[model samples]
Target: MSTSPPPLTLEADAVTRITRWVAVGALLALIALCLAWELWLAPTGRRTLVIKVLPLLLPLAGLLKHRLYTYRWVSLLVWLYCAEGLVRATSEPAPGATLAMIEIALCLVLFAACAVQVRWRLQRAKAAAALG
Candidate 1:
């Protein structure tokens, strides 16, 4: 007879659900901020900079679906925005610098949400396995 490991159930408790919503909200805010900053609030010489928002769009579907892999990868992905925000906040002036600061804040929130959701989910799964 062949033996197989039990299937893992990914359930969202209240905290996990809240974290997921927070992640989604932060992500949407980041996307909107990127668009407004590049196109309206402070446009660079080349509008091409707006392309930076593309990668942010990639995680939307996965996030909405609450995929664990998406949360894991997005936690790593948010750092790039943080770096960009840090660089711009230091180099740019006035509204651009302010916008960068906002970006940094949103990135931090998003990262925190992803990290919390992933940790909680994994812990829950481990506990379930133990009990099962």
Candidate 2:
């Protein structure tokens, strides 16, 4: 009579939940900062459509719904933002450069959270399938 230990399903659930919230928060912060930076902070005096922040809104609904597929895709998508932030941070002027650095931080946090959530959720699904 061999019996295996029960899976740590609860721990996985908690981790997935925490990571999902973190990703959501980071995304929201990034959006807000982008809007504020573009609309107010910079000395650019000329008002332009805050197109830079619009792309992030595309995944907002899916992320709020806790869609694992969205998490996977957004994780990959954030790298583009990271690259843009890196470039702007180095070349853009003072406040703009500072905002770009903040963008980089937020993007990295969001990407890491999404990646961990996806991995944890996938592993949980696999474990559930194996247990049946």
Candidate 3:
């Protein structure tokens, strides 16, 4: 009788390791861009709304879809962003410079939260999968 192992699955452990790093790197890069903008950009509130916040969100969206981040938390964060944007838009004088700054800051916080949540989820999943 043959004692050969089954053919390697596409989801080999090593591939998951590589994928985890790739996911982390991509999210970190996006987060870094937000940090750069927050730190370096002058307090002029000069950027477009869609251009500024939308890109900041792409990573979180990816994380949620990929299960790198928890779906529930990511969904909540998306809702918060939408609410903040709406509030800032409606609050007198077009969200104001201060409001814009607040928006960006909140975005940074949300991204950080997503990062933490994704790491936690990945660790939990890894542990659960290893118990067999």
Q: Quick one: best lDDT, which candidate?
A: 1
Please write out the lDDT profile of model 1 over residues 29-82, one tens digit for every residue.
999999999999999988789999999999999999989999999999999999
Q: What is residue 103's positional error in candidate 3, in angstroms?
A: 2.1
* 1-132: candidate 3 lDDT, tens digit per residue: 544444445555555455445544544554554445444543235443335545445555565455654433553554465465456546636325455445545545555555555565566566656652
Residues 12-93 of candidate 2 have per-residue lDDT tens digits of 7799889989999999998998789878887355656478778899999999999999999999989998998899899999
Q: 129 in model 1: Cα distance from truth in Å?
A: 0.6
What would you estimate as the lDDT of candidate 2?
0.87
Which candidate leads the pack in TM-score? Answer: 1
Residue 23: error of model 2 in Å? Answer: 0.5
All candidates: CA RMSD (Å): 4.1, 2.7, 10.0
lDDT of each: 0.93, 0.87, 0.50
Cα error, residue 115 of model 2, in Å, equals 0.2
The collision pairs in model 1 are none
Clashing pairs in 2: none
Cα deviation of 132, candidate 1, in Å:
1.0
Clash pairs, candidate 3, are none
